[model samples]
Structures are given as structure tokens and as C-alpha cells.
Target: MNPTARQYDTVIVGGGPAGLTAALALTRYRHRTLVVESPEPPRNAASRGVHGLIGLEGATPDELRARAWEELGRYGLAERLDGRVEEITPLAEGGFDVATDHEDTIWARDVILATGVTDQYPDGVEGFAACWGRTVIHCPFCVGEENADRSWAWVADDPDHLGMTATAFRAWTGDAIAIAPPWLPGADELRRSLRERGSDLVLGEITRLHHTDGDLRAVELADGTVLERQTLLWPQPQRQVPLVERLAQDHALALNDGYVTVDEGRQTSIPGLYAAGDLTGKPWEQGVVPAVTAGSAAADAIHFATLT
Candidate 1:
């Protein structure tokens, strides 16, 4: 069933840290906002603290969201709906009509895309999928502290990405190992860095992952040797949602490899549409800090819209 329009000044897509953060910012600016969030939870590792944000280091992601939600209530301008946004149409009145999976419509003067990205893990890696956000992770800053002093391994499906992952993991663990696939760049440098960092460099094809009840125990190579490790750190390739692709097609929204492009102010290519967080495509995906900053900037830009 489709929902009818409930008037709002801004409609934010996604309910994770990015979307939630943006909702808070919009309310603080006193803009009536509707945040449409799916019931599905993020698969990323649980965050202990939001890094790179001054004065909020070591604060859990949940804690940050809770605090922000409380502040947003003071402004009386935000509402949350537990449903997925199915589509968005630009209205003739210089606003947008956002349609949800439940058929609810939200009419807003502006739209904010806080929809995040998803990582596609390589295929045929047994037990690998189960270890995600647990012993296997993409962001070191998000999961490294918990893995401190544990035997860590960097597994690459392609040799080219080995050096990059290996170099990054060195800062976290001296016991780290780099396992490269065939044809990657800078092998000697990667090996040297591993040695200098007191880590190991294992170059070969990974045969399989040996685990006990989804807890990673070791990585089995083709040679039949098991490398003992408690955690695996690597990046996963991501793809954006089709709704964002349509957003770019209908509007002049700029996209870099399918991610919505935004300026320092977080405004999208289209007027009144803003983007932030993972959808904005920063190099490192700095977690909560990026989401919060982008959201605040988007709200500030929308405030300018009222003045103009």
C-alpha cells in the first residue's frame, strides 16, 4: 500500500548513522524533517568509539546516535518512519515527494541521501561471509582496537591490493601478515614493510578458511598449512543503490563511480538535494565523524535555502 503525503521541509533516506545524523542536524536548524529508515540493521562491525571526531573519541556509535536524537527532540522538527523509501519524485513546487515501500508519501522541500554503501566480499571463501563484522572486517579504525595483539592476516583476492592493505595493517599489529594473489604491484616493498614492522608476508592462493562455529580459527592455504589468526582485515568492493542512480539521471547530480558527489557543504548537484557519509565517497570512510559532519553541513545548506 502506498502512503499519502505528510508535509515536511526535508526528507532523509536511510536510518543508519548517516541518515540519523542528518535528521538531527536538520532539526537543529529548525527544519521539519522526515527520516525514512529500513528496519534492516547495518552489517558493519560494532563501533567502540567514533574516531577523528574531536571530543568524542572512544564513544560508541549507539551512544552518539542517542545523544543526537535527544538534541533533535528539542527542535521539534524531526520524525522517523520504519519503512524503506521506494522512490523519489521531484515536485513542481520545488520540493520532492518521497514514496516508501509501505506506500506512505512524504512531501518535502528538500531531500538528503544518507543511504550508505555495501561491500561485496569475494566469492568461494568458505566461512568468510560468516566472519564479517566479527573476526573479519574492512575498517581497521572500526575494529582494530578489539583485535589488538591478536594474530592478524590481510588476505587479498587480487595481488594488486595486497600492498595497500598490508601497509595499513602494520600500524595496528606488528604480527600482521600480507597474503597476496598473483599479479599485484609492489611485492618487494610490501614484504619489506612487513619485515620492518615485524609482520609476516605470505604470498600465495588462499585455499579456504577454517573456522569453528563461525569464529575464524585459521586460514588454510593450498599447501595445506593453517595460519593461526583471530582476525582478518581487508576492504570490500561496494555498489550503490539503484535509487541513487535514478537520482543522478533525473537530476544533474554528479556521481563518481556511482556515489553521489557533494561539495564541502554536502550539497548535491541538484538544488535542495544533499548527500553525506558513505554515499559521498570519501577515501577512508571515516565512520561516524564523516556522517555527522556531512549531515550538519547539509542542514546548514538547507537553512540557506530558507533565507534565499
Candidate 2:
């Protein structure tokens, strides 16, 4: 190691549930770990509370993150750096050189990319962005109960995902209104299923979403008609983060259906590199347990590999 080198047994590229959990596990193993939390807010930043995560139910995103960081603080082997990663370079000997936007560079024997994913919002919908994570949510499991019992709009970018999202939202609301084009694949069957469940379907694109800060009011249709609603559930398409793109800038980063492909151990195609959390699969499938499991698994894998 260089005389002034900042080195770690492993460097984690996110501070959300996954990265934090991984850091906790690695530090508990007495390994030096550094967790880099991006300056950007988390995916559910606007949601008032987090659900489906036992013991931490109803905790807001800010609260959950704060608690996670505080817990990691109890372990002295972990360090937290708040900055955006700009570049990552593989070393000739081994390990990685990670550069951040803060003009800081660090080294690690291994890297875990819990970097997460970014949602691609619809372009022309009015107030959709503003209402997202507030009145408009991704999963019913995220903020279901409080936003339940009333009519809610469910938007699906792909028809294949329509049935799954529609069924999930039905647990909270009886009258499920799915905002999708009628021509998409599997539309008729999904529509039939909705009707069978005493729910309704809205076939077409969303023109606008009307909502307050934490309450939805209505949804406007392309035909100049509006439906009263208090919540809008959307499972939009998600893309990988910029760090993944930068890693693939010169060469192809192996992706399976636009997600970073990892083995059972959570290591990516590249050796000494790994990815967990929503970056490895559907972003909406994220919660505390899954994040913790994936993160801890990666930490254990790195530890066992190091032992040999």
C-alpha cells in the first residue's frame, strides 16, 4: 500500500439498505469497509414512510437511512463517504481505483456496486413527476395501507408486467385503474382478470395526474375525461445508474434484460466486482430484507474468498 493510500478490504458503492447492510456484515467480520453514499436522494425519497420492512415499518426514507448509518457507526471498521462516483479503474496488480466527483480517490481490494437504478418517467404527463413517490407510488407494498381503500391508478410501461402490478395493487384497492395502451401484449387477458376481480381498467396513456403533496385528487384522460383518485401506482421502466454506464463506456458490461447480471454469489461478470440491490434485478422488488440478504451474502463471499 502507498504511504498515504486510503485502502479497504472492500468498497461499497451505495449507502441505501443494501450497501449499509453489506458494510455492517463486512465490518462485523473485522474487515475494513468503506461505504459511499451518493449525494443524490434514494429512489423513494418523496415517500412519507416505508412499508413491508418488518421492525422498520412506517419509517420514512430519511429515518430509515439515518438509522442505518447510525447502526453502522457502532462498528469502527466501516467508513462512510458521501459523494458521487465519477470513475473506476482496475489496477494491474489487483483491486480498483475509484474516483469521486469530490476530487477524492480511494482503493479497495474488492468493490460492491449497490448503486441501484433510475426510473424513466413518462415525458408528457403533467404532475406525474411531482406526484411520484408522494401520491404516485411504484409498489403497493411500499406505502400500501394508508393509501388503501380508495381508487388508485396503476401504470405499467410493459404489458407483460401489467398483470403482476394490477394484481399487487388489488390488495389495497378494489377499483384498480391501469393506465396502458390497449394494443400492448396480453392486454385483453389482464383486462378480463381485472373485471373478474371487480376492478376497472383505463386503456390509453395518462395525460395528467392531479394531486396534492401527499394526497392524489384525480387523473385526466386523453379524451378529456378525468377519474377521481387518491393514489396512482406505477411500475415504470428503470435503467442502470451512471456508474454502470461509465463502467460500460469502453466495453460491454454484461446485462441481462438491462440489469447487471450477477451469479448466485452476487458477483458481477468481472472478478472482484459485484452488484446487489435493485441494480441486479427489478428496482421495485426492493425492501429491507432482500437488500440485507444480498448485501450480507456479498460480504460473506468476499470474506471467504479472501481467506483462501
Candidate-wise lDDT, in order: 0.74, 0.80
Q: Write the per-residue lDDT of candidate 1 for residues 1-308, one digit (tens) a residue.
A: 12456888889887666777778767777778888866776533344456666776766766766676777777878887888787788766678778888876668888888888767777777787777766777778766786776778877655445545445665667676777765557677678766775665776666677777657789877667788887887677877776787777775568987678788778887777888788887537647767777877887888887997
Question: Which candidate gets the maximum TM-score versus the true structure?
Answer: 2
| Model 2 residue pairs with clashes | none
> Where does the lowest 10-residue lDDT sum fall in candidate 2?
157-166
Encode model 2's per-residue lDDT on 220-296: one tens digit a residue: 87887788888877767889888898786643568988888888889887789988898887756676668778988
Structural similarity to truth (TM-score) of each candidate: 0.84, 0.90
The list of candidate 1 runs beyond 4 A from truth reads 1-4, 43-67, 157-171, 185-197, 212-215, 249-252
Q: How many residue pairs clash (N, CA or C atoms closer than 3 angstroms) in each of the candidate models, in the order given? A: 6, 0
Backbone clashes (count) for model 1? 6
